[model samples]
Target: MTGVSRLDDPMPDSPSQTTPIPPVDGVLTMFYYNDLQAAADWYHRVLGFEKILIAEGLVLFRIHEGSQLALVGKGYGSQQPLAGTNKGAILSIQTRALQQWHERIASHEAEGIGHELHRGGNGRTVEFKVRDPEGYTIEFFEWVE
Candidate 1:
């Protein structure tokens, strides 16, 4: 990952740059799936995530412009189980073409439409929720301008 070290590095910080030290640029939600290969394929096909690399039992994917998702085989690697069920944390992604994504996801499983395309978040966004192959929630939103 690219970084600038700190707001107070060796030299003086530049004003032309955005935030001195961005609280957080991107997020990589890593998880362990029962079958890494199948999980990778499902994410690639259904969720439209491209595989960046796969070695041993781990798989990395680019979920969006700034976010990523990494998956590992359950028994193939060492990792403490993440808490909660398939309905645990939601992976929210901002989209420019909500309608297109809606159609694509709905085609796979109509029931994945948990929130039934609606305008929410103080009417500032149009979004919907869907479950992945293993039941984790994935939310897609389009900012309302």
Candidate 2:
């Protein structure tokens, strides 16, 4: 045989390569509601979220620093059990001022209709749950430690 290297042989001096992963900046939570306008208004009033963008049947809001809350119009075949109910899925909001956050949510008359406050898993966070007009539950909390 001739003194030549095989074509299918792996290279010994080449470094291993890896695929680059994309960085996650933040999360955008989507909630489906039958009445998009009503749901948007309710979230705006309750969570102090301002409308960032409004499309055909969707409304996007900037809830906090890096988080976004999107309200999608229902009846587009994306229905879930929690779509028109307020008992499923817990949306959490993290804050630095627990007491102030609690006070602000507690002071709302609309919150009094369905808002409940409790201690978190570690006992270092205070959480409050409230429902929007479309019957979607949202949980807001602040870290005490």
Please write out the lDDT profile of model 1 over residues 65-100, one tens digit for every residue: 768898878766567435445545677888898889
Clashes of each: 0, 0
lDDT, model 2, position 66: 79
Which lDDT value does model 2 have at 135? 65
Off by over 4 Å in 1: 1-19, 22-26, 76-78, 81-87, 114-116
Q: Report lDDT (CA) for all predictions.
A: 0.75, 0.68
Q: Which candidate leads in lDDT?
A: 1
Candidate 2 error regions (>4 Å) = 1-21, 80-87, 111-117, 122-124
* Superposition error at 30 for model 1 (Å): 1.2
Let me know the TM-score candidate 2 reaches against the reference structure.
0.69
User: What's the CA RMSD of model 1 in angstroms?
Assistant: 7.9
TM-scores of all models? 0.69, 0.69
Worst ten in a row by lDDT for model 2:
11-20
